[model samples]
Target: MVGVSKRVEAPSQGNREFTMTYANFAHIRDIAYDLTGITLSDHKQNMIYGRLARRLRALGLSSFDDYCNLLSEDSPELHEFINAITTNLTAFFRENHHFDFLKTTAFPNIIRKNMASKRLRIWSAGCSTGEEPYSIAMTLSATAGFSQWNAKILATDLDSNVVDKGRRGIYQEDRCTGIPNEYTRYLKRNPSTGEIKIREDVQEKIAFKQLNLLHQWPMKGPFDIIFCRNVVIYFDQETQKKLFARYHKMLAEGGYLFIGHSENLNRVSNDFTSLGKTMYQKK
Candidate 1:
């Protein structure tokens, strides 16, 4: 049960602040957990308040209770709510070392072993805005004879907004700064607006879709690599355990898993062994 209070209190601003009591905040947190498997701690109160405040105005609702009621009553609105609250902070070659390993070791080994099949399968789970999958595409495109192989990357996120952006394969020119010089071949420049784009060839290798990791996955996989980096950090221990188990099942034996630098599987999982940094190998 959420903590329901009689008195509604809003933080004071110049005019009016969003009214969110501890009870309402608790309910929101619970819904987020139930829907997306993300555990929002108490400290995220201000963040939740700030973001959902806009939703309240858009819906013409005055109270957090009304918003929570709408959430229970409506399904489509829940999707919008999830899209709004989810954090999507990603960039090209983020935590670059993982991609380095892929270019130097994993991809080469997998490609060599799979040369006859001429197929490469990679999944960028929780791939926000497509940078990670685009990075995967560039890594393959940079490697020797990558075109000979039928490479594919499955990029997915819970946020439909970010997934659509990734599918568009366009980014502000400044956002492409972190791309390495060797892999710059995969980017094209639009002189009209100076926007940077993932080359169509590279873009073709990826499929962007909206997915919630807690839910059932539609695609069957024996993927060579999976990047769930900076994603499960928000999940509870049990949720992380289940997800890692699913990742283990989805991966080929000795396949790679790349997680956030701060994340670990020490206590939560035994299906994977650390290969240093945030990389893990299925055991």
Candidate 2:
């Protein structure tokens, strides 16, 4: 975040000639892939230009080449660049069924099985702006006997800016729209700011950290449930295979793994058994 510039200017309304070259685009794509494991295709060249153009303008750089040159050097701007380009489109309960599964099936089984210890661990991988992890927290808290269980959740994203927001546990009022009615009790309005805030009970249950799924994880444990929805859709086939394999190894036997609605595991890794659309249990 230190290296990334914060200055932003609105794009001129009409079409403008592009300044970036194919080589520059290729380099940017490579950087995103290598650093974040996100595949930025050629069609997204205009998008890359639009997004990075802000960074260039903020830094007062003359050209895309100037920006490309910084990539080869040790620059903190790279951190901001990924944060800018990486998509963070999410809302409370964006995928309702996944949370439904957690409340109805997965969590009930976990609560039943672990009643003695009353412990639960959930990972919200690629948690954007804390909505996903907070959603998990609220769902668990609303469950019967949930307070009796020592529930913990790990929420992570590659974007530091979003991670910071997640840590703050605040959002605009409209962002609370899609959250379920039952869980709305945990959300209260900040009278001064008119913004939504996740209650302390739900907020404290989660630990949000900045993480790149491609990197070596310091954690070791068989997580009871992992919510990696929509994160792997950006990765290539090989990367997805390796990522899922690592997840399989980390997930407890019979633990649940939830993926994006549009993502599938066909021909990827067979370490998990499919439990219908966008759901798998580690085999």
Q: Which candidate leads the pack in TM-score?
A: 1
Residue pairs in clash, model 2 = none
Please write out the lDDT profile of model 1 over residues 1-283, one tens digit for every residue. 2233343443443454566887787889888888898888777878898899999999899888899888884567999899989999989999999989998999888977788988789999999999999988888888886777878999999999999999999999889999999988888899999999888988999999888998999999889999999898899888899999999999987899999988999899999888999898989
Q: Which residue segments of model 1 deviate by more than 4 Å?
A: 1-15
For model 1, what is the alpha-carbon lDDT of residue 108? Answer: 83
Residue-pair clash count for candidate 2: 0
lDDT at residue 32 of model 1 (Cα atoms): 88
> Which segments of model 2 are wrong by more than 4 Å?
1-18
Give Cα distance to truth, residue 135, candidate 1, Å: 0.7
The residue-level lDDT of candidate 1 at 155 comes to 97
